[model samples]
Target: MSAIQIYDTTLRDGTQGEGVAFSVEDKIKITRRLDRMGFHYVEGGWPGSNPKDLEFFRQIRNERFRQAKVAAFGSTRKAGRPADQDANLLAILESGVCTATIFGKSWDFHVYRALGTTLEENLAMVADSVAFLKSRGLEVLFDAEHFFDGYRANPQYAMAVLRAAQDAGADMVVLCDTNGGTLPTELKEIVTYVREALEVPLGIHAHNDGGLAAANSILAVEAGCIQVQGTINGYGERCGNVDLCTVIPNLVFKKRLACIPEENLVYLTDLSRYVSELANKSPESRQPFVGTSAFAHKGGIHVNALLKDRQTYEHIPPESVGNKRRVLVSELSGLSNLVYKYRELNLGPERDSAEYRRILNELKDLEHQGFQFEGAEGSFELLMRKAYNGYQKPFRLETMRILTELRDEGHVYSEAIIKLRVNDEIVHTAAEGNGPVNALDAALRKALEEFYPVIRNMRLHDYKVRVLNEKEGTGAVVRVLIETGDGRKSWGTVGVSSNIIEASWQALADSFAYGILKLKENGAPDAQAP
Candidate 1:
């Protein structure tokens, strides 16, 4: 098997996505992570295009990389200027990197219309730029911009551009599907034609406008391309670029291509999540191999079968991608599902005992009331622990009242008063907030802290409310999911009720319960527990 190279452009093209911006610090962090992940090349950014990218190339000069080579991206020289004198070409050469990638117009329409240059002039610009860069002892990768679409429009012109790059001594000619509208079959045909036409090694750079970037990249490789360029988690312009998370695994495992080492494959899931979190973007759940919910089972039958033999239902084992199998409990759960869930909670189940029935009945009742146990397994596990006499309450909630007043201008004021009992002492507190839920949570925490000072470490990280069975309209069932974190561990809890306030209270109560349970398990003394 031949070794395939992986080129990541998340910091460059990925940042071209609207509403997506990365600071220089963010670029350095992502580059370091990608380097450690064994990516063959990392396109930091286009130096000379922006101040931040220029600073990145300068700052990164002091850092050392493990496996990935940094490639500075830019366009070819202008129509009128010589390669060395062209500002764009000179900027790329002085970007402080030995490897540089330059894009040239392959489509004649772009040459005449966009660049306002003749076809021969465009070809001269492409060949001269590559030759000049090579003469300066720089590794030049020529990106044939819009190669696939240009081939469809005029095959001869597109082939002419590739020949121009090859004749100019370019290291590699990367075929780019700039419009991202070409299908896999079309890419295969075009790549095959280009591979046979040029003597230089071929590379692929695909976009995801049609959501087929990964598919098209793999197809291009199968058709004889040796290098693939993509982002870590499909982060790029428009629909995003090819997701290397999917492409790497598909090539190494599915297609049996030799690229990254087998041990490096296990880090895909963590690397994918780390990049998403750093970028402050939510990871796609349906993303091929590394997503959180990719191998998760929610249906009763599926969970049951997976518990018995995961291979019976899974395409690839969860561990293969560094992800664990998760059995989600919901309204569709059965006895086997409950049994598996109980085992995960470390609570032994008595198959035919009344306690088992009680637990199952409690879960069903909670589900009917709008509690999604699957999404709030931390809360479910706490419930099981409390039922098994393993949980100790941190503080007691004696009373909670939310007062709301609507102003004439439609502004609203919400205030809450909370009373709690801790260590045979009662504490009362009040707080004002922008909303009823916020005021209630604030007052509750204030009252608890008055009795147990350690409660100050807890905070609400995320709060989500969903209307269940919306046909009920204003009287519809409401489900609240509260994610609480204390700088270390984070857990989610769920609650449901017809009134939004009541649902929020249920989730808030579970948040405290889970937090207190964790503290007790860690051997921290709960001053309020009796």
Candidate 2:
């Protein structure tokens, strides 16, 4: 019921996730992004662990952030090593950050097994580390590593570890669910007990191995934890940390607790995708709140209710989190789907018109033929426009040929020759590529660039091919979905055919057509639609 501090460790713990890495520049950029979005703390990785993180702290040391304090993360002093002389503790002090977060073993089993230190020495390490950092005038957050597990194993020892840090001037004592296996109810009860026992402010750091990091984090907050530490998009070691993307909104909108600035919530989706892009990973399409399909309606029944009142299907306005409502048309779509799309497009037949019904029937038939429009809104938009009287394609493909050659030395080459009629003028071109689809794309662009020069701005960003019927094997119908972008925006177009090349060409052609229409809408020169 109070303001919850959001501590993001995406640049630190997030990189621990397999296949997730970011350059020092990426860390700086994320820091700036999180600051602008009004996060309370941004963990800048352990300076003593890696050179990149050390370089990040060096570069970001002088940069003044608006709202977030960049904390340098490291573990408490090593056993028998004085906190002042410890390399990890000294690195945190040298990082030039105003805040420091240091973790120490809370679980008694970790003391003897992992650290090979006595229980009393572990407590001394926690106390000495916190006191030394506080003496340096840094706001220290003491992270009780494996706190939940420790409390469950030896409740007295875990409380002693936290008390040592608190009595040594730790600004905040953070409870960590390192293994991410704590149930929500158990976590809530434990955190509530800890809250009553400790005078220091409490924070929750949860992992997602058990898939309850987000839920446990929320419960911890309900039970009196004031801060929630997590990573963007749930990126972290093993399963992941709690996803701040999911946590922030739930706290802000549901619990009526302030996290980030509510106005900044509109940028959450873009931030999630931006971080994913920098991480060089594909965004999760089904991720809650910020995913592409978060607010997408596919079934006809859902669309019908959504058309009347979006609250019937949606929990919140998609725009609130920088997402949009999508109504997908497929074999399952009814009249309401067409009605919603037609209204959104602002160009299609009336809801009561026969043309509307015809288009709906055609959409269903095409989907039945393995042409999916759910992920190919560009193709669906094109279908709606083509339904208009006298609508013509910008260019007509006259003929195309592909040749693939493999030599004895194992070198292979593919070439495409294309002929097109643009404004009734013949354009012939040939191009080579790594594959037949790429060659065809190149050849088509080569022929069209002269007439519709805007085509040069378009490039295929993604191409996915799915076998419609795997049982048919070589004879199976294939569905090709191509995502194309014109620098500013992207759209998906789909095609279906038994021949892969033909299917690729269909999607490719639609992608170009849609790109040109988009360019024209934006007032790009020579981007005329036929």
Candidate that scores best on lDDT: 2
Q: So what's the TM-score on candidate 1?
A: 0.93
Candidate 1 per-residue lDDT over residues 1-530, each given as its tens digit: 35899999999998877666788999899899888878899999999688888899999889899888899999889888988898877877777898999999999889888999899999999999999999999999999999888898998998999999999999999999988999999889888877777789999999999988999999999989999999888888888889999999989888988887767878889888878877888678788889878888878788778778888778887787787777777777777677777777666645564776688788888787768887687688877777775665666778888999998899899999888776668888899988998898888887676555566898998999999898989999889999898877678898888989988988898888777767766777653454
Task: List the pairs of residues colliding in candidate 1.
Answer: none
TM-score winner = 2
Q: Which digits, one per residue and each the tens of the lDDT, describe model 2 over residues 269-327?
A: 99999999999998999999999999988888999899889899999999999999888
Candidate 1 lowest-lDDT run of ten: 345-354
* Residue 420 lDDT in candidate 2: 90
Q: What is the lDDT, from 0 to 100, of the residue 308 in candidate 1?
A: 80
List candidate 2 stretches off by more than 4 Å. Answer: none
